[model samples]
Target: MNPLFAFDDAQCRSLAEAHGTPCFAYSGAVAEAQFRALREVLPSRVRLAYAVKANPHPKLLAHFASLGASFDCASIGELERVETLGLPPGRTFFAGPGKREAELRKALALGVRVQAEGFEDLARLEALAAGALAVNLRVHPAFDIDEGNRIIGGSGPSAFGVDEEDVPELLRRAASLRHVRIRGLHVFAASNQRDASKLIAIHGAVLDLAKRLHEAHGLVFEQIDLGGGLGVPYAPEESPLDLAALGRGLSGLLARHAWFTGELILEPGRFLAGPCGVYLARVMRIKESRGTRFAILEGGINHLIRPLLTGEPFPVKAVGRGEGTIPYTLAGPLCTSLDRLGEVALPDLRVGDLLAFGTTGAYGLNEGMTHFLSHPVPPEAWVD
Candidate 1:
């Protein structure tokens, strides 16, 4: 559980030497293992759509596809990524707000399942298609969690789904549309939920809503895309995603809602890929100011951007097996003073030593930039 030294001892040396510092290292086997764990719990009726935004690298997506997993794309661009990989149309789902008209047209053309976020999107899709457009309803699940602590999707006044009270009317409206087809219901309120009961409650609520939608509209659902937010461990002692509990809960829910027959979809982003990768950086300098030790890394917000923008902390560990204890605040190479990674209690540090951060698989690479300092983009390696 020591994130600092969790990988195969020999493999760590191999990665450091070959990929160099400040690079992201991914494990293909780890990714597959995570997928397999979840797959083992659910029935064959369930289909996992690896949320591409988690790690959209071509190789990563290709690996998921090989594991017989589908994809959950938030935009046409993400959909196009899956399309290029030759995944089947029905296996891919397009879900998110601000789905433009052009994007809807493209999704329809490609036969990708659509989860309409708002009434405007539903109306637009209805107007464009000649036949019932394969659609999913995103319901705004009531969550008992804070917004700032949660990720984009769940709870906290999310603009992602229709209100529960309006769902029946929404389905009625969809039924009225000659070109709109409502096939599934989706709900995702938050990610990184350590509480298993919250997820279970969310899923149950979604199923309950699905039941009402079905009864009210006579719509037989073919899928229920429980938008994935399975959290990965960030702290060294933190447990990895509790797959056993999630699977059991989901299975129980399916049994409870036996009347619904269709694929059970999960769009997991962090759970699959977060622990499988590490962001490496070389210490450029060690300085002390105002009683604070600063370890300025070669890469900055430009290279791995989220922490700076959101003030959220990512798990970090120093490489090279240092044993001494010291406290230091890590900062990116960006000129802006705000580009901080996080403060960590570490031993004596030296320049050129490699530092790796854990649980950055979700947004570290895919969402970083080359702005400000514009240091050369770091390289990446995928391991089995």
Candidate 2:
């Protein structure tokens, strides 16, 4: 069975039959294996913080927590989810562009580290912090970011972190803040990048940027967060990221940058969660419009919208159906014409034939427009 598809045809059929069509099934074993695979390759100084935006399934969170994984939370909801894990302080991080006061308060109460995106974040956090607090300053580097798909929106303009050029001014103003101290740096400049060499290049640039900040601004960093863009294969043809090479590159960076003794942080969402899931939906009907062959599934962008947003389809297969030369345009039950999963070549699909989408564990139902059509929400089965 292909590694991309967490469940085989037999398993897919079982999951569809057990959980009903248009539902999702995730393999706990696969998730653990993926975490261990990356963890084993990483240097001891590197910290793996599982990004909660990927899949906030309670069971998944608990499982990761049991494996001694730290969490990277973006919103109050994510923070709350991680809070339920009952982990100690310093294990959870709160990071977002526009954090509300309530969220900041909650983060402070929980002792979660905040990734301050701008001077405003620093000010807000300073006011909320009781005593001394350390935060990692998220920097939008001026360097060009090579992305296959525009997820983070490259270096030109973004609403995420403070721009690299404006860092000095921000720091100058932030020095006035009494409670909030910038002790670390965070740079996220890659998206869905599979090439290990390319990832290393981006990481190297971030470290170089950090070095400049340390030397020029006198900023001492205890942690440098290289934001998550770790890529996973969505198709069989695409190569998986070389974990060994990535590990070696990071180790090499540490060796080169001997001045920095702080731990490197990697927040991986999709890479850690994407491979462990399979979205199962049965073909509701088959339609041939003009020259396009359409296989309308029980679900569409409502359950998995990554394809619609990224123009890249998740690897899908017809359950129990062998490979074929027939082409298919997978559609959903939505009213809009834009509710397309992808156009791909699959075996001859029939009505009620089960279709399983692979690599959907991350941005599957959690990221979908489930409330759009008032359709019954699909149940997600966590397979052990």
Q: Judging by TM-score against the true structure, name the best candidate.
A: 2
Model 2: weakest 10-residue lDDT segment is 141-150
lDDT of 2 by residue, 79-180 (tens): 999999999999998889999999999999998999999988999988888899999999998985678698998888899899999999998999898888
lDDT, candidates in the order shown: 0.77, 0.92
Can you tell me which runs of candidate 2 are displaced by over 4 Å?
none
How large is the C-alpha RMSD of every model relative to the true structure? 2.3, 0.8
Q: What local lDDT does model 2 show for residue 173?
A: 98
Q: Which stretches of candidate 1 lie over 4 Å from their true place?
A: 1-10, 143-148, 153-156, 309-312
TM-score per candidate: 0.92, 0.99
- Model 2: colliding residue pairs: none
List model 1 lDDT by residue over 1-384, tens digit each: 454223543565678789876678888877887889888987778798999988887888999899999899988889888888886678788888788888888888888888888777789988888875778888886654443455664454567778766776776666567777777788776676755667788778778878877787687888888888776666667666567787788889989998987888888887877767777788899989999999999887776777766676676666665544788899887878877888788778888877777666677787887656667777878776
Residue 71 alpha-carbon offset, candidate 2, angstroms: 0.7
lDDT of 1 at 355: 79
